[model samples]
Target: MKSQGGHFNKIIINRILATFLLMFVAIGIAMFLGIPNPETLLLIVLVMITSIFGMESGIVSIVMLVLYVMYFYSAEHSFLLYNRGTELAKVIVTALCSLICLLFCSLVIHKRLSKR
Candidate 1:
């Protein structure tokens, strides 16, 4: 039983790490490709992560992405984007979409698991 619990913990850790890795890799590729808007790519990645790893990992990924945007994408590296409404809008839209995706994926997963 103890070993089973430890194995489950390891799986959780791996999923969390994978979530971050996927986000970073997507961002890197978008930057390399000179994509004007990486937020769309990130949203798709978020949905995929949520569907595969479940809501907990998805929420962590969302928070990390939000912090990244707040720091790097905002004006003066701060969340005070008083003059940059577009950046603020992007963040808001992305966060809301990710949350919707997360809820949908969670429901689908719960239904499938319950059926089994």
Candidate 2:
């Protein structure tokens, strides 16, 4: 039989995987549509989806999304984008927006969950 801790860990893992997958799909869609500012809205959506499972998952999803966006920008620009101040600022803004959305959504989720 599985211990309670093991089951909890499994849920956490599953949350991470699900968040990652959803973010991947969102990113892909944005890219396919040539949306340069997709994160502005996509981050909110991603956080909302992850927060359904738990606050931690919502936080993790935003963190992972930020990292992925950073890497993706570097890759798409052949690493030259990092040398531009405006581009770097855009990345920072994106990360901040994502974090802010995650915090707001997670708090709402926490409050809802606690009421049960």
Candidate 3:
């Protein structure tokens, strides 16, 4: 049981590291490609991470993505800029959509695994 717990911790750490690495790589690629809408790419990355690493990682990814956009992409490069109603709305909507996608993916994965 002790060994099982250690193994589970190791797996969780690996997934978290992988999620962070993937997020940075996606951001780099978006910057390199000069994508007009980098959030779209980030959203795809969020979905992929959620599907592969499960909801915990998905939630982390969503928070990271939102913070990245709010800080790095904002005109003032600060999270406090959300005082603008439209900006706040966009972030809320994006986060909600990411959560919906994560839930849908988790349900599909659960159903598939339960069948086998």
lDDT of each: 0.79, 0.72, 0.81
Best by TM-score: 3
For model 2, the superposed segments whose C-alpha errors exceed 4 Å read 71-80
Of models 1 and 2, which has the larger lDDT? 1
Candidate 2: worst-modelled 10 consecutive residues by lDDT:
72-81
**Candidate 2: tens digits of C-alpha lDDT, residues 28-97:** 7877888777666577666677567666667766776776567656636564457567767767888888
Worst 10 residues of 3 by lDDT: 68-77
Off-target runs (Cα >4 Å) in candidate 1 are none
Q: What is the C-alpha RMSD of each candidate to the true structure, in Å?
A: 2.0, 2.5, 2.1
lDDT of model 1, residue 59: 90
Give stretches of model 3 more than 4 Å off.
82-84
The per-residue C-alpha lDDT of model 1 at residue 106 equals 91
Ranking by lDDT: 3, 1, 2
